[model samples]
Target: MIRRMTDTALSEENASLKARLAETEAALEEAVEAQRRLESIVGELQREKFAARSEKLDPEQFNLPLEDVELAQGVLEAAQERARRALKGDGATGPRAPARNRGHLPKHLPRIERVIAPESTLCPCGCGEMTRIGEDTSERLDIVPAQFRVLVTRRPRYACRRCSGAVVQAYAPEHVVPGGLPTEALIAQVIVSKFGDHLPFYRQAEIYARQGLALDRATLGSWVGRACFHLRPIVAQMRENLKAADRVFMDETRAPVLSPGRKRTKTGYFWSVVADDRGHGGTGPPVVMVHYAPGRGAAHALRFLEGYRGRFVQCDGYSAYDKLTAVERPEGAWQLVHCWTHVRRRFVKRLETDGSPIAEQILHRIADLYAVEKAVRGQPPATRLAARREHAAPIIAALRPWLEAQLSRIPRSSKLAEDIRYTLGLWPGLIRFLEDGQLELDTNPVENQIRRIALTRKNALFAGHEVGAENWAMLASLIATCKMSDVNPVDYIAQTLRSLLDGHPKSRIEALMPWQFRDPSSLAA
Candidate 1:
């Protein structure tokens, strides 16, 4: 009886040990999963902050429009031109090196041929006048520094001798500014120089003065105002076209506006609405419409997007955007897709400030995502979706638990913890791109448009008034659209003004849109 009782106790203990072992194995599996998930999510968090390598904006390297490197190149070219002119003026014509692949001049520039016949057209052997032969041609670029000449218009009144007062002078040629001094071409040059070339009106006035013309800053501004009045319809048309797109990119930057009584410049804002189908392999031409507002309030942004027909909008995770998605609207609610670049930027700052290993890890992983994005760019949506599913899905899946685990490891109250939480909060929107290949991984395209506006704001210093700010917005929109459509802002504006002055039907303004512009030469290289 004693032996059997002892055997029963031993059996019970062995069974208990086996059950405990199984429980431990299960716990170990869970821990392993958590570790992997933590890494994956952390990587995503970092990537969301840093964005892609190509999209990285370094002010030192790429201040854009006004980049230091470009400025240096211009200075060097000017100096080279001066030296060449001096050497030529000295009249020391020497033998030139034999030409080898040297006749590649731009086809657009007008060529002026100058023949340099041999001294007496006589042969070295005293043979009378050498027989005519084929000539060797060479090209040298030359510039006629903007010669300002007045266009004199004479309207002669000729009353018929045999009939009633029939005074006519072939209706004075049309001008962008009726009865105004500056012609459409001149106005176009001012607009291009100011916005496209980033020259302020005062600087332009100085440049004109150098050309022996008296154009004050105020006079220039008036011309711009007159042109702006005529361009209102076109700007409105551009807005309608942009809003009609199925997907649009939205971004904003601050501008300085002169205050009436504050004795200081008041802050204003510029919003850019971009519709670029080329990045996604869509056939429609890309366009951008710039809008100016007095403040950076949600109201301004919402108003910018008011009556927006597009269902998908890509933008930064600004609080103003909170009012966008899941809200009632005329066209129902639209989906708000967050920008991974904005998210990645935060971690980039973190990594720069303190070499956080987790931040580094996340940035590297995000780079992986960008690599996938770059390869699939300009490809069909189905291809992008397949690539993301095959590659990005596994990374994101592994990221979740890893991110959660890292959160536990770090100090609960630290900024790292905070960043991770912020990233996790936006996890749904960030990961939403995994299914939709139509969406971009970031807002780089639209952000790029904002750079031009930034250049204007950075240089122009400030707008004189709210009206002036509006003009900047209007003109900048046209210039930005012209660039996207491959049309030269100066040529397009000049021709469009002529068309308007010649009475282009208001109802047919669509024909004047940048992409619809008729003259191919007006398109820039």
Candidate 2:
């Protein structure tokens, strides 16, 4: 009887140990998942905060809104699957993802059909063909590889033998590059490839060579320079149009330029001045004017903003921008509207490195502001302002005291303290979004424009000269604007070149804007 009781006690002890082990393992898994998520958030914020130039990732590197959405979607789906399994006594357990809203493939896309048939359609018993039935179909996206094509232009000459008159032939068309081997369309492709797709000229030449065309890089680049030279007026006009807006966004990225004889590169800056009002339901086309400056200093910013008509300019916390607020303005007082995204970035960095609870709380509060912005986006300024007053103002009112309290608790010399101080320092500008609904909560729009410049800069490594950099800026601006307007860069560039060569009137240059672009049956001077 004592041996039987001892065995029972040992069996019960073993069960208790197993139960505790399972609980411990689950807790470990939850901790690991939380850390993983924290690391991902920190990494993204760090990349944005530290990778100052080219602002954020491009596809060649990273950053698209789709990326964040897809990530969240994937995590949510996995959690839901786990929850479903766990309800039936599975090991995994976690939060389920929110309901998904998905879209079908575009109906406008051309459908290619392929019908598969069984080896024998005959019925086994009757040895006769079966009656037709319904079909099941699915679609998968596909692409046709790009290939080079040629256009052989011939102008036939005619003469009247009886009169011995001078032979008559149709005059060859005016080309962007007179008597050049490339057609306007081909030149457009080269410009689009280099500027829009971020493919360099030499890379383009190599691509062409693979297709049995031996075009040299210099030849292709020559076409680009000529096209940009003529397109200069359009880019200049775009800048004026952008400045005409009551508010604009501006950002700058580093540009490495080759020092002609030094055999090294000198650092230059590409300033992106943007005008986009769609977020507040303003009926204006978005424009990006990338200006190349020899340096990123107060002098450059001052000179660039010289003719800007607007008083409000949204940007980061660069000291040069601070000086703008003090500058004399004909339109009234110059205002430096700061970006909340920049403020949040500092705390995100602290969170990742220190795992500070303070940073986490700040991020959550900032997220609340963004959620309110999302609801009022595209609404009228008054509507947005009303919503902000209702939803975001209270959050800000509560956050300020909390920030100061936290600041008082942390060491004054600590990095978190420094970040909190930065927030407090820019308190006015950061909260300015709450005052005006027309303004954005961040300078993401301009940074997004800088992203294109950053990507091409990465691929080309550095511009061969400052002039080359200027040319890059001009073409990139036009192409990016075309994209914003949902116009094909290739078509837009080609049409513009044709019209310009055909002497499209200088007074009508405004009609040549990408958003105003259209194809006509005939183009001749």
On lDDT, the candidate that comes out on top is 2
Candidate 1: which stretches are off by over 4 Å? 1-103, 132-135, 156-159, 164-167
TM-score of 1: 0.80
Q: Candidate 2's residue-wise lDDT over 337-388, tens digit each? A: 8888898888877786778999999999999999999999999999999999
Q: Tens digits of per-residue lDDT for model 1 on 199-233? A: 99999999989988888999998898889988888
Stretches off by above 4 angstroms in model 2 are 1-142, 518-525
Candidate 2 TM-score, C-alpha based = 0.76
Residue 258 C-alpha lDDT in model 2: 99
Give the range of the ten consecutive residues with the poorest summed lDDT in model 1. 48-57
- Name the best candidate (by TM-score): 1
